[model samples]
Target: MHPMLNIAVRAARAAGNLIARNIGQQDTFEVATKNKDDLVTSIDKQCEKVIVDTLLKSFRDHGIIAEEGGVQGNPDSEYQWIIDPIDGTTNFVQGIPHCAVSIALRHNGKTEIGVVFDPMANEMFTAARGSGAFLNGRRIRVGSRDSLDGAIIGTAFPTRYRDRMHAYLELFSRLISNCADVRRMGAASLDLCYVACGRFDGYLEQGLKAWDFSAGDLILREAGGIVTDFMGEPNYVKSGNVVSGNPKVLRALLQVCDVQNLPAILK
Candidate 1:
C-alpha cells in the first residue's frame, strides 16, 4: 500500500471499530439534528475526532475537512484529508448495522487514496489513484452489466433536499421500469462501495456532501467505474448529485436523467 494510503486505512479502521462497538448501544450516545432531517450522533463526533487525530499525528501540516468538525489543520496545505466518520448515522443510531467510516486523501485537489470501512461487516474497501480497488485485501471490480436492463442499481433518497424529491421520483420511476430492482440503502458511501465490489450495478443520489462520497468515488473509479453529475460532467463534488456505474450503465443512467429535465438545482 502507498504510505499515505496505509495511514488512511489505519485511521478508517480505528473509526470503524469505534462505530461497530457502539451499535445497539444508542442509549450510551447522544443524537442531534443538523440541517433539518439529517442526523448526527455523539458517536459520529467521537469517530471524527479519532480519525482527525490519527491523520494529524502523521501529517500535522495537512488540512482536514470533516463532516462534523468542518475544516481544520493548515488551511493552505496541499494535502487534505476528507472524512465522514459515520456515513450512515441514522442506521448506526437505529442499530441497522450498515454504517461506514470513510476517509480520503487529496493532494493539490486530486484524490490520492480512499478507504471505506464497514465495521459491522468487517469489510474494508480501499483504493489508491493508480492501484485497483480492493475489498478485504482482494481486488474488486464493477459488475459487467452492459446496460440498465436487468441491472440492480443502488441509491439513496434526497432526504436533505426535499424540493428535489419530485425530480428524484421521476428518475426512480424510470429506473425501476428498466432495471431488475433498486435499493435505497441509506448510506451513500456503502452504496458506492457496493457498486465497486459488484454488489450493485450502478448508484445515484442527490444532496450529498464531499465527505459522503469522496472516498467511495475514488474506490469506484479504481474499480473500473465511471462517475459524473446528472449533466454528465465530472462535477459531482461541486453539485452534490452523482451518478456512477460501469461505462455503459452510466451512459444509460445519464439518458434517463436527461429525459426528466430535472431542475437546475439537481443538475
Candidate 2:
C-alpha cells in the first residue's frame, strides 16, 4: 500500500470504530438538520475530528476537507484529504448498521488513495492509484454482468436537492424498467463500494458532495469499473452527478438515463 493510503486506512478505521461505538445512542447526541432530509450528529463531528487528527499526526501540512468540519489545515497544499466521517448519518442514527467512514487523499489534484471502512461488517475497501481495489484485504472487481436485465443497480434518494427530483425520477423510472431491480441503500459510498465488489453492477446518484463519493469512486475505478458524470465526462467530483459501473453496464446505463441531456435539467 502507498504510505498515504496506509495512513488513510488507519484514519478511516479509527473513525469507523468511533461511529460503531456510538451507534444506537442517537438519543445521547445532538442531531442537527442540514436540510429537510439531511442530518448531522455529534458522532459525525467527533469522527471527523478523529480522522483529521490521525492524518495530521502523519502529515501536518496536508489539507483537510471534511463533511462535518469543512476545510482545515493548508488549503494550498498539494495534498488534500477528503473525508466523510459517517457516510450514512441518517442510517447510523436509525441503527441501520449500513454507514461507513470514507477517506480519500488527493495529490496534485488527483485522487491517489481511497479507503471506506464499514465498521458494522468490519469490511475495509481500499484502493491506491495503480493498485487494484480490495475488500477485507481480498482483491475485488466489478461484476461481469454485461447488461441490466439481470443486474442489480444501486442508488440513493436525492432528498437534499428537491429541485432535481424530477430529473432523478425520470432516470429512476427508466432504470426500474430496464434493470433487474434497484436499491436505495441511503449510503452513496457503500453503494459505490458494492459496485466495486460485484454486489451491485452499477450505481448512480446526484446532489452528493466531494466527500460522499471521492473515496468510493476511486475504489470503483480501481476495481475495473468506469466512473463518469452524467455526460460521460470525468467531472463527477465537481458536478456531483455520477454514473458508474463496468464498461458495458455503464454504457447501457448512460443510454437509458439519457444523461447526455441532464445538465440542463440538473441545473
Candidate 3:
C-alpha cells in the first residue's frame, strides 16, 4: 500500500468506527442545521477530529479541508487532506446505516490518495495515484456496461440548490427514459464508489462540496472510470456538478445532459 494511502485508510477507518459506534444514538449528541435541509451532528465533529488528528500525527504540515471543520493548517502547504467525516449525515442521524468516512490526500492540488470506508458494511474502498482501486484487500474495477439501456445509475438531487431542481428533474427524466432506472441514494461518496465497483453503472449530482467527491473521484478513476462536469469537462471538483461512469456510459450521459440546454449555472 502507498504510505500516504495507508494513513488515509487509517484515518477513514478510525472515523468510520466512531460513526458506527454512535449510529442510532442520536440522543447522545447534538445536531446542528447548516441550512434548510443539511444537518450536522456533534458526531460529525468528533469524527472529523479523529480523522484530522490521525493524519496530522503523521504529516503535521499537511493542510486540511473538511465538511464540519473548514480549512486548517497552512494554506500554502503543498499537501492538503480533503474530508467528509460523515458523508451521509442525515442517514447516519436517522440510523440509516448508509453513511461513510471519506478522506483524500492532494499533493500540489492533485489528489493522489483516496479512502471511503463504510463502517456498517466494513467495506473499505481505497486507491492511490497509480495503484488500482480496492475493496477490502482485493482490486476492483468499474462495470463493463457500455450503454445506458438497462443501466443502473445512481444520483442525488440538488436539494441544497433548489433553483437547479427543475433542470435536475429534466435530466433525470431524460435518463430514466433511456436507462434501466435511477437511484437517489443520499450518500455521494458511496454513490461514486458504487459506480467504481460496478454496483452502480453511473452517477450524477450537483451542488456537492469538494469534501464530498474528492476522495471518491480518485477511487473511481483508479478503477477505470471517468468523472467530469455537466459540460463533459474536468471541472467537476470546482463546479460540484459531476457525471461519472465507465467511458462509454459517461459519453452517453453527457449526450443526455447536452440536449437539456441546462441553465449555465448548472455547468
What tens digits encode model 2's per-residue C-alpha lDDT throughout 1-267? 788888889998888888888887877898999878889998999999989999999999999999888899999999999999999898999999899999999999899999999999999999998989999889999999989999999987677777877878877888999999999998899999999999999998876899999999999999999999877888888989899999999999989878665554457
Per-residue lDDT value at 154 in model 3: 92
Q: After superposition, how far is residue 81 of candidate 2 from its true place, in Å?
A: 0.3
Native-vs-model 2 lDDT?
A: 0.90
115-164: candidate 1 lDDT, tens digit per residue: 99999999999999999999999999999999888999898777777787
TM-score of model 1 vs. true structure:
0.97
Please provide, for model 3 over 1-267, each residue's C-alpha lDDT reduced to its tens digit, 9 standing for 90 to 100.
888888889888888888989997988999989999899999999999999999989999989998888998766799999999999999998999899999998998899999999999999999999888999989999999989999999988788888877877887888899899999889999999999999999998888889999999999999999999988999888879899999999999999887448774474
Q: Give the TM-scores of the predictions, in the order they appear.
A: 0.97, 0.97, 0.97
Off by more than 4 A, model 2: 260-265
**RMSD in angstroms, all models?**
1.2, 1.3, 1.2
- Each candidate: what lDDT? 0.90, 0.90, 0.91
